[model samples]
Target: MTIIAGVALLLAAVAFFLLPTAHLNTRSLVRVNGVARIVPPETKVAGLAELEGLQTGPGSMLDLTGDVTVLGAGAPAERTLSGRPLDPDGILPDGARIVVRHGDHVLEAIRRVTVQIPYETSVEGKGVIVSLVRPGVPGERELFKGVASGKQAAVFTTSAPQNAVIERTSSAASGLKLAALTFDDGPGKFTQGVLDALAAKHVPGTFFVLGSSAAGNKAMIEKIKAAGHEVENHSWDHPILTKLTTEQIMRQISRTEEVIGGSRYLRPPYGSYDAKVTAAAAALGHKLVLWTVDTRDWETPEVGAILANVKAQTKPGAIILMHDGGNNRSATVASIPVVIDWLFQQGYSLTTVAGLL
Candidate 1:
């Protein structure tokens, strides 16, 4: 076969192998063989369904997520996700849910509606708040309360508000080709080595230092900051925040903040936190910072593996998780320069977690 024809056949084979499952209703991503697939959160739903008992036609108004915007029931339009145009008739991804009503009859089958609410306050609020359309339909405000007037607040229906907020924000990352390198449980013997590697690259990273560790390694902590790196909280003893009481959680964060002089960000140990934990962090005016590309360097994996893991998963606006503490991190130290070189070659700007935001 000619080279062009051979290449076309190979492309066709790859597409067939990677085709998504059809008929799966889970999480609204592009389906292939009934299995959920990853799609951008902003992708619009192809067709809007009428309420089960509503007399409205295909043009019936639909409330997508919590945004009071226009949704029409017409032929599908091609749209992009992660920079690629999705199938025109693609079903809505699972990032959001919708609801509609006709008179007293309500048609709501969507799950996890709370994903639509952005928590501007503590996630531990006694009552969750959500935005809803005043009237289920346009011009229907003449019938009842002024809900039809515009957007209004309602009680969110979900048991895990923290998870919903996390899901919502997960897809909200910017399209910038910048990534943040974060070192957790730091101020250790290998910290200086890691810092040296970073210095050679002229890149600054965020170090999630432990309170107890920082207390003993005060000079190292100071050095990290002195070298132009950001210091953040990683709890007092690296306990799981989800299992701790409110007071205990407060202490973990407060003690770290005290030792670090002060911190505006917290990285919960093991990346675990429930609503209560999130609220506690918020109450202290600290933003929760989680990683996107985990180097698994804490496990002290093979040095080559550490470099490979970072190079494979690094992406735009990605937060790369690594470690500068917890026993031998020589592998992590050695991997830094190579990873930084690869990132630079790939056109990524390395910065602190706060800078990525």
Candidate 2:
């Protein structure tokens, strides 16, 4: 072989041997909740605020904002970099990544720290119930191999009260596409505005009324019902249901039933419920109604953000969650027509929760 050809072969062998070490020097193995992943080397994040912003920004799915626990691999795990324990800033070591753990707060429902739910279903069928009594505590993310046991069990019907019939319809069965809009914690000062918006569009929705609010705002609740909308239960006062005993939960539910006269459905406050809460609600002759699309209107985000969220997430058979009470809901009121117009353009017929079912 020519000397140049021999030299070229020798150089190729040297490069092959160095490739693994070069890769190890530039990439990091990150394990989020024990699932292995990779991040670029030197992917340092400083301060909780920055970390949270990065996690929730466009195109990212991990959220580290709420009550988080951080753990660092190697020694000196207690080190602090940005006013909080541990650090995410600077180059991560080759083959090592920091772990961030936080309670996963689903927008539409309560989530168990240990359980995996495949889809939305009634509380009883899931079997695993999470109570408000034990709130989530942020911990360091650890390696976890989550196993989804199987599909949800079949619905077991019992003798619910005669009045406890939640309306459910099948658009597919009827050859129509339908959606539902639901307002929670209502009968507040802003409710009339919401009603006015819906009225302008000639649209009907479901209102999950709070018993405490209903007693004081009977006229508002009546107005909601009289306007061709459905009025259902959202507890007497909004409390985390899982935090209360069965008796307390019953009281919260039953008192609202008394004020509303009777309800075919119940919406647990904060979307927090477990088996016990569902059982208590079942005895009261009510079915649980949770939302599918959340506007996060309570945060009083920019009106455009509210409208954007609804526009982006609405789907057939979806229950769109908005609020009529608990804050300045003018933004929510503003979003109504925008959402309705877009949905109508998309050929979706808006209806109450019962209508969607």
Candidate 3:
């Protein structure tokens, strides 16, 4: 009996040594911030302190209320557990992803941008002879932009734009019995007839020729010049000067100047002009010339009506508008002689616009 009891006791001791304890059986495998770690069975809930010690390298204990410095900017740090906000003493789960992000801090700054200010024009005095009283100047303004870190800027304040002022003065009518004969859109087929009429009467006139037309009709331009008539700019293709930008206006005037070798006067198409056109013309040393009388010759009016329009509108220091080209100008070609004769008969001297001025 003693021998049997000894055997059973020995077997019981062996069995107790081989079986696992409750603490060892409850051990769990968990990931802390993507790292594998073994949590002891005694730690039912884990916090930042427990995770900090589990980290491979020595690091500061997680501070819930401290600022984090990132890329020269300081802001509060945010802690998360598995994509959700982590409480100061929250439970940590197995296979959880932990993330920490710094909140961006806002900063204020000023930004500057340049803006173009167009000039303004003020015309004074009367009559056809115009002179510049004051030249124009361009101005600028300041724009203040408010910006925040990692955000778009907003405009908070802007200075008013300063506009340049330009002034022009004109002379009163001279009251002398003198009228200026001006032709437009010319250097074409009917140009010779008009030139012959002016040459026969020994009178000087102004011919405002288009740059395109002048480039193609070089001989006609030469004839107009040789006949003692003034050759001026009528633009290239005759666009409304007011409708074009400043650069476009400059191109139109400068191209014409280059083609005709330059002129001091420009007659905008359809008698159109504005502050921008005036400034552009002045930049190239050209002056704007407009007519005091309209013959409406472009409408193909009757020769008698054309002559009558001339008779009524002709006055001292007047610029008479006519066209030698641009379509069906036979009536204008026929009225040339009669217009000159009546002007002479009415005791009006026929001369170029420059001469009248």
Candidate 4:
């Protein structure tokens, strides 16, 4: 064959050998760092990698502990994994998952999340699919060996959240030496219990509705407003304001304003807020109210825990933080009667945030 014809033949041969019969999904990103070498569904690798000895021959014996490469589509890029050449057959195309091991060193690339956890990562797609590969021993956080989409792989990292602690406002909200027992992220399935408790004690509080939650439970939001309580801005989505830009911060709060209407007041989620978030609220002519004391019922579910937090935190004019929504708020609701009776007996009147400020 002529040189040109020979090259064409070789190209055809490689194409026939490497092409996959399936279409690929190419969304999501892959990042690799740290001392641990692992492949996730969001990473990519070439067949010519100088690791696991797959660059030249398909017969290279892999350690198989971390090495999970299989024969698939696309040309393998030339590279090195530790110190061995990767085989062409050992290369994965887009959406392929592979794992490799070299001594104490283990590596893998999963290109997609087998299970997409519904956390506040991004507001895209319906949700994530959780995938289970090999079976594991009962009840262990199964190390997600990998996530694979259509064309890449990555070793997934469980991200730990870093939150800027919100500064406590020292002064209590004004008026009547009244303490506003504000419950945020509420009007959920259990909110009626909180309402009943509050009503029984003849105390009125505030409910800062999250637009997302209120969308599904509008009546609850309406009920709180109707029940002599204050409805304020807690954002459409309960995101940390410190994580958002100016416009996003406004959207977070304003979207809730739209749902709740121009009523008044704003509470940052997780008590997380700053000047920018406060600015967004101010530009819209809303008061940025920070909690003077955190009842932290979201973390500790016991009624005594909730009561301890309240007693330790409450004072004259204190704006107490409690929750009506976002996960199980039963314990918070339970503390209402005891706290109301105690506070009222102690001459602290229970009033809406609007009544106080």
Measured with C-alpha atoms, the lDDT of residue 30 in candidate 4 is: 22
Taking every candidate in turn, the Cα RMSD to the unseen true structure, in Å, is: 34.6, 28.0, 10.1, 24.6
lDDT of 2 by residue, 66-99 (tens): 2212222112223332334555555445444345
Greater-TM-score candidate between 3 and 4? 3
The superposed Cα distance between candidate 2 and the true structure at residue 224, in angstroms, equals 1.2
In model 3, state the lDDT of residue 212. 92
* Sliding window of 10 residues with minimal summed lDDT for model 1: 132-141
lDDT for each of the candidates?
0.67, 0.67, 0.73, 0.62
Query: What is the per-residue lDDT of model 3 for residues 191-227, given as tens digits with 9 covering 90 to 100?
Result: 9888888888898989999999999988888878887
Sorted on lDDT, best first, the list reads 3, 1, 2, 4
Q: With candidate 1 superimposed using the best TM-score fit, by how many Å does residue 269's alpha carbon deviate from the native?
A: 0.3
As for lDDT, the candidate ahead, 3 or 4, is 3
Q: Candidate 1: global Cα-lDDT?
A: 0.67
Listed in order, each prediction's TM-score against the native is: 0.54, 0.53, 0.63, 0.51
Runs off by more than 4 Å, candidate 3: 1-113, 129-132, 144-173
The clash numbers for all candidates, in the given order, read: 15, 9, 0, 65
